[model samples]
Target: MNAKTETPAIPEGACITAKVPERGTALLGDVVVNPYKLAPLTAIIRDGGQAISAAHVRVLGRGERGVDIAYEVSERSLWTYGGIPVFGLYPDHVNQVEVTYKLDGERIRERYQVYAPAVRLPVVANQTAALPLVEPIKVAPGFEHRLYLFNHLLGEIPGGRAFKWNALGGAAEWDQVGNNWIADSNGDVRWYLDIEQIHDSGRRDGLGGTMGFQQTRDGKLIWGQGQTYSKYDLLGRRVWQRALPDKFADFSHEIRETPNGTYLLRVGTSDYRRPDNKRVRSIRDHIIEVNEAGDVLDFWDLNQILDPYRGELLETLGKAAIQLPEGVQKQESTAANELLEGDLPFGDTPGVGTGRNWAHVNAIDYDASDDSIIISARHQGVVKIGRNKEVKWILASPQGWPERLKAKVLTPVNAKGEALAEEGGLYAEGFDWSWTQHTAWLTGKGTLSVFDNGWGRNFSPTKLAGNYSRAVEYRIDEAKGTVEQLWEYGKERGDEWYSPVTSVVEYRADRDTQFIYSASVGFLTPEKLTTTVLNEVKYGTQDVQVELKVSSRQPGSVGYRALVIDLARAFS
Candidate 1:
């Protein structure tokens, strides 16, 4: 027999008296504050009868520097039976929220004064005093209304004795240190994900927090931490969660959604055996394509695709390439008869070392136009591979590469279309290949944009005082096998803008600008500190329209990546 349809029950403790000002609309039944109890500065409005077609919420700012945060509830199902999720409420203040929703093709607007109690922000271990989370160093006029999501590590440095390799018995819990947060133009934290809801407590490995926090085109946030990958709507609602397949051990670096609805995840191989029958574990050198159902469709093992032993740059710079913050003690040789491991002074999560990190692939971007994958390997260079795992092109200095692989490296050319000498072409005038780079992706114009970390610049052993990182774009002529520099930033600022560890460069076609994130700017003078600077630069002129710096009192606080939240996407 067919089961009878049951009426959906109203949410528990929902305010039934909440109604539209004049319409007396009882269709919008209950209003519950923080329905999930996870996102503190949020609320939920249940639909009694009429389904809400759309919703827009705006939280008023307090002062001139405080920029108002607002977004439209993009997910329709969020307002169907569970409740309409409200976001961007100010903590410890009577936040003035302007809510507008459509019911039965009629628009209904209401004003809500939500007083969200202040919450205690997480403190890193060894910190004895309270410190400001993010500071607005510079706010440009036209870019006053923007939000940036910073993916960072908040606890004490990993790879230490207390939080070493598989030790989870550290003094600070993963939940206590927030690894992901969103801040407005005024440097006020508008929203943050309580890592407690996503961190895997049972895991013994130190890698438990989010790594790559990014918003999808549909206005949902997605990230990969350890072995789990999760996607959640802006309302702090988990849409779906998937785990890595058995072959993959841990997820790191990046997770990107393909146009075909599959996900490209950067993961570590469980136990890989070399051609010489040497069994060993590798990290951050594998990429797998998994569907929404958690099925591994295709895999790109960097060990197989690239020469794993190519370490000319790695050996020259050693641990200095990663620029580990000051005060972190370097590890000595262990008594146990184990393989010699390089020092990852800041933490192992940064994924820099000699063994098992040959091709530290920190970023991945797919090109549907030709079914190709572009990756940024810190030890190696920016590489593009085809569906069959064949190297399409290598964009790096032609040094120490095998004769066969060196043939695939692109030749550098000057602006006047003259080919520079291959021996020192990389450091030639107006052209230089990135060293220890981070995020490499194809821009809308089909050109490649990379966050050139500039570590080991020109393969130099000493850290030059003039060393600088830059957001560089290159126009590659595939048929000609040559590359030309298109535009760059941060090089003019010199060492002050050099971020050796993690950063990103994204092209914003909508605004004709580039979003450059300098994730780790270490200052060791008066005190050891790390600052993250974000800039939105104009396309051709290289004018910095927005410059915001995130300062942390905790030394060695490194930011992994930062992305601009496209608020307009929520309404679209």
Candidate 2:
């Protein structure tokens, strides 16, 4: 499908009339379902995917602020270019009205009366912000510990200098204590593990950042790289890193862990080669398989699975169209004269997988049960991948990752598929990030929490410059790869602890006490009122207590002292 941007005249509450490619799909096909108001209407197709880009998304409006879309049909897990949620629209099912450019722009339409007959609000809707901290609530308990590392700078030079963001140390698993190890992902390689004082950088010089993990027991751990799954002993010694490279082309995207002690990594580049420079750009999004010793075993690619042909309904391939899913146009044979030594075929440059697809990733997760893998793409929202690098299902985000949630359904539900109100804040348009993902976390109860940073500029309503960030926790209905809404982290409903465009995870389970916990947005240090200002409730509950880490550091100051907040008032 043609992926480019051109302003289309959008009229409110009128028959949708938008730009159309000479041939292919439009942003909105026709009669679409509008879930919020519960009606349907004719909507317009705004900015869609594109032919080429350096970072998957090139901010459209100003600098680095436009909508980023993957025109590939099968991979239509649409989000704001920044991994945030944008509204979704399809033909004959739902009508979508969007206002992505301004802070107040909202393309409000009625709900589809005929579509989704069974979908209804759990209780009457109300606009308010009040969420009570429920039972089993507490920041992650901790001891005197810190593991992992960080990259101080964004490395973008030759030979790739090792860097760190903020590597922390502690028990790796929050659901279990026996599995105590510190781990970190320096926004690069995820290899900083601290297992009972086992430090085996091997002088390889590794960096650290967001997350970390390390096994507690003694044995060779299996973590996959490209083609080869590497093995590492308890002492951080490289036992062996090996994998059959048949599908290990570019496994540098990301990684996750299996409860069985295995590792799940990514392969394939998310960028595309430029026809002008013959240089592949932004080719860095993919999923791979890895083991403890850091060996690459198997791999999968969203490019081969999401059929772009389906998007042809919106528009035909442009002169610079990248490869679409399932529609590989057989290339014509070219003479050696047609080849260039400076082409991407050389070692220094990146590959152009079929010379088509763009840079967009699916779901990313690590399973502790049966060591399975779950990946969703901006194009293909859901995929169940296994250690053998096999795809089991193509699923959708839970409850369609509902951008909008009713206050009543926000309550707890029974196993028979009922809804309850848990909090009150927003009816979100999920994963509408303009640039890329901010955070993706998996809970022990099969919950996938996503921090969708709203940043897209193309799809309308992106220009609004407000604190428009939120966090969402998804309870996966594995039978359909559908993510159901359990909770959201935002200010409207009081779910957010911090308004961080960038945050980290500190998850753990207390083995001795049988407790699961977390503490982020700065360590448990006092003097930094960041945590309390963002998350700690100043209210009172019979069970839950409110606490804060007090510091004399003025609100707008530069540097300040760090100390831990003491136990104070209860809120629950």
Candidate 3:
């Protein structure tokens, strides 16, 4: 929260005039690099329970002796990872910095503690239970190993269906060549997954999207959205069917498979009537263990696990409000400004017995490495559940990260280089009025990154290289649970399409590439892509779909091209 500062250090020939996260400064460059890939980084750090990556850090300036160490930790690309975007480095009081990492055959155990670098930090500590199995399926023999990502609760999508939530129930199988990704869009995470083949254009109630496994069987179609149809062969033919008992609840979530090829899904009612609170979708979120034949073998639910922390931190965080002393009052008001602590990324789960029957699941992704299932809570933020039903990570957003009323007036950068937030404006969302959009993740060499779709204001005179829509990146410090801003691109990046009112966000880590593929769906669609970053490159390829193509070429038709400038070669 830069208040009384201005004249930020920027590379020469960079954007001379523009906004930060909102109105992006455009740049000129040939396609030497896609420009949209990821920016290089010199540092990385991770902190807290949730894994975050940051780019820069203050090495304890030799000044204020043992004073508080405040650094600029940018997190423009945070929400893409199902987290929040809190750019800048603030006061994270710590006396020492200690880090320890262990590398075993194929495992890595790294502990990071900022208070004391000599000791390690505790990322996660929880109890786990054992689960028994029943059925067994067939797997091709001679397979060395396997990886899977599973979601326990097949939930629903939030934000009215435009985007998926991060906390979803699904599973994915990963290997060297490729991995089969299955998730339950049932909520936010895609649940249905099968690496071997592609199922029908999987969808529930015949919706365009569904949660099911992806397998290739000659072209047959089978979706696990409702778990009704039997398995299909390559020829679009059902090879096996299930004989469901009439009175059975007839459904479930968390479909985990055994090494022997057997699988099960968790089942439950919308909300179970509890003695303390009765209206919590007892049927909504439950853990049902079933055999591959759609038969129930075992079951569990949140009601069973119930707040393991026993309402200690949850309650403390709930009522924990930081009191700003009178002398340091940013906004002097008689009402003693207090700060509320909890900030869940997705949405906040009603404390204990709120009796609120609403839970929105956004997206789900399977992690084969540790066999953990990652889910996004649009209201809560992030929740990672291990195979044993242990919530390894319950990372809520930092209340300080958002609503910086006092932090705003101090935000630097004013109009005409005024160096004031008000004059220059606080955040210019390249486009205005956009509530929020999609996001993607990126991890490579030295930076853990995210693509922030600043969907607020669409137009700004300060765009640099391309057209005009903003996408920001952050250097993630997973070990320290931190993030730093790396770069911002939008119309200045030679893009014709300004930030869309609403669109999809996805990241392809395979090609070490991330993309922000949006559309002009909502409020205003600023003539999609006039010119992409390609046309500017001497060897650029126009065949690529970056530029907008309009045949009539009318007065307001789309026909934009990116302007490339090879800075490296320019000086030579």
Candidate 4:
């Protein structure tokens, strides 16, 4: 025998015809697997003649670790008469899918055996493991039904020829993993966005990846990073991707859809000049609203709206050398001194990672009821501003504020409506302002919910040992200029649950629960390993219904935020 050749096995239901199948026939037509190359596990079922009014797809589990993933295909015009998209298949396995769809007022059920090849995730420099190592710690009853999306940062050790600021190891490292992924309650990876499809792989600056991953009302996913933002459908179809206008640079943190279909972006201004006409690069101090055409409709320059030189909290944390992570003490204290000693010059400073890291804004939310914007500034405080750029109120301590802005600071009040005593920026027993907070959003009941990072609490360096982070809710009376604490969690856990930076708090009205993400937990440990913890706590009882932890073999892998995604709602 000359040779033995083996032919590849053809997948069941694979399209083999030379001509394209026609639509509007009596029965189902050709089935094309992975029609969109980006989504390898998804398939499209071509419709025959009848219009599909509804669809439900289920991918059965394989082993003990696998769990069934199911969802309904949306009946939008994009899919009613066209091919039905199938999601939630397992990788590298022959998946058994159960599909139920309604066509021409009649119900039809079918079975599918689709094979999805395994995909190899990108590996960062000096790291052997791939991205995203999810570990489930606690899964309460019914919690397994929900899926969570994590924005992961893959830590890459810098090469030789270190800079002066290399002492801040974890803080100085750049992220190599640039994609956001989803995992079930059982810790199985379900889906992820191929960031290279929208962004260039060569460009990795300014947070190094995407953030603010959220779904729009029309079931499209959106995120912002570096200098661009993108929108995509669930089937990995790119709707549109746009870069910041010429005047802006480094779009970080957040990008959310407004009520009128515009987008509110947290971005940095280009060629920002100081009051003395000194040109300098600004970072994380600007917000812009843009239309679908990427035209800037409005902008908010914090340098103009607020006091940029007011670095009371920045100075406090700098002096303590506690800005980065807790136990990782600064090798040289001069970095902090240089930033606080005098007015910063035009160029980048020694201590600051970027140019002029003042008023480090990390989050923004739009209030459609009054067209106001709420922002969480890590260096300043959570603030709400009117459409005219006038400060409606500030949710921060009254100390060290300019007289004009101090008047806008809200007073802490007790449940009984009594003003709480403030001593050195510390409020009495029940209420305290959020410190280094993130994700300050208005809840359905009109209360403000914040992830109080509790950094530099009470603005006292000596009180650092008692610091703790929490998901806190406050009831604010704008007319009375007062805020009352409604509920809180995580303080009781103390330092064990503290997250020095980057976290989120979300309220789920349907479940009557609060989702809290402690993204940077244990960042300051001696080992330098970081763990992300997510908890779903019942509102009134304060009982944790679900607790999930995400860790990685790659040291210093830290998560920025975790979002609970309801697949059925997102797809349908």
Model 3 Cα displacement at 122 (Å)? 54
- Best-matching candidate per TM-score: 1
Report each candidate's C-alpha RMSD, comma-separated, in the order given. Answer: 9.1, 29.2, 26.2, 8.9
lDDT of 1 by residue, 92-113 (tens): 7887766666666666667766
What lDDT score goes with residue 566 in model 3? Answer: 17
Candidate structures ordered by TM-score, highest first: 1, 4, 2, 3
Off by over 4 Å in 2: 1-153, 156-247, 269-286, 290-297, 308-359, 368-371, 376-435, 438-441, 457-464, 480-482, 490-507, 511-572
Which is better, 2 or 4, measured by TM-score? 4
- Please state the error at residue 22 of candidate 3 in Å: 66
Residues 30-67, model 4: lDDT tens digits: 66666656555667777765577566667776676566
Top-lDDT candidate index: 4
Clashing residue pairs, backbone N/CA/C < 3 A, model 4? 24-48, 24-49, 25-48, 25-49
lDDT of 2 by residue, 362-458 (tens): 2367665756666544322334556565554443322212122111112233344454333232224332221122335465645655544333212
Ranking by lDDT: 4, 1, 2, 3
Each candidate: what lDDT?
0.69, 0.29, 0.26, 0.70
Q: How does model 2 fare in lDDT?
A: 0.29
